[model samples]
Target: MARERLEIEAPEVAVHLDAQDPESLRRLVLEACQRASTVRTDHEPLVDLALSQLVRGTPDDNLARKLEELAERTDDRYLTAQEAADPNWATLFRSARLASALSLALREQTRSSVLNSIYEAAHASPDTAAFYRDLLL
Candidate 1:
């Protein structure tokens, strides 16, 4: 079944998310977060939008690892988006990346409306959810 496109639009930006390939979907999520962050320095909204849309698309182990790696990079100032000419954009990227990593890690346990969409895609069961929950902490 084809996943429905989740359209996120702001005055200067419009992102369409419906890619079937996990890698493409991950790229799209990052692109969307980058674009949204450029428009607004605040990270939560953009990260939430990208992650919510990402869960609706597809899931891949490599993509999950990429998200985790992104989160880890935030600890290194030189490796983070913060070092870019546009420091605000880098901050946005770092924040969004962290949020994405958490979302992927707690995929089965998160209950937010956006996070729930990912559970649907994965069809995670109670045991799976419990496993994720155990890892929480």
Candidate 2:
């Protein structure tokens, strides 16, 4: 009887990083952010599809229901945590939470377009436009 020895070799991997180059660093950061966003939404295919329809201003009952559920859950959690002590703080917190939820729901470009449309609508009303402009300034 004879015994033979088996050997395994690990594969080599290469990563390039140019710390001093601003453009390279910017590209790296952008790629990382894009990957992170994709991974964040990859687990929910139905939600992503529904949200894509929403981005196009399409009405979806499923999406609406999901959003309603999300809002209810968020409100419940906020109350459970007892973070609604101060009126001002509660309003700010809820607004910020809603904005964060929107960010997660829509893609970057769609979010920008939606927000821009909202701004435009605000400006379309002469009375409110002036107030909006004042707030911005």
- For TM-score, the strongest prediction is 2
Query: TM-score for every candidate vs. truth?
Result: 0.29, 0.31
> Highest lDDT: which candidate?
1
Clashes of 1: 1
lDDT of 2 at 17: 25
Give the TM-score comparing model 2 with the true structure, all chains together: 0.31
TM-score attained by model 1: 0.29
The alpha-carbon deviation from the true structure for residue 100 of candidate 1, after best TM-score superposition, in angstroms, is: 3.3
> Model 1: per-residue lDDT, tens digit, 1-137?
53221111111111222213445444433333333233222335534554555556544446555545644554454344455665554444444445444446333322232222322222222233442233221
lDDT values, one for every candidate:
0.38, 0.35
lDDT of 2 by residue, 48-97 (tens): 55445534544445554554465456456556556646544443334323
Model 1: CA > 4 A from native: 1-56, 78-137
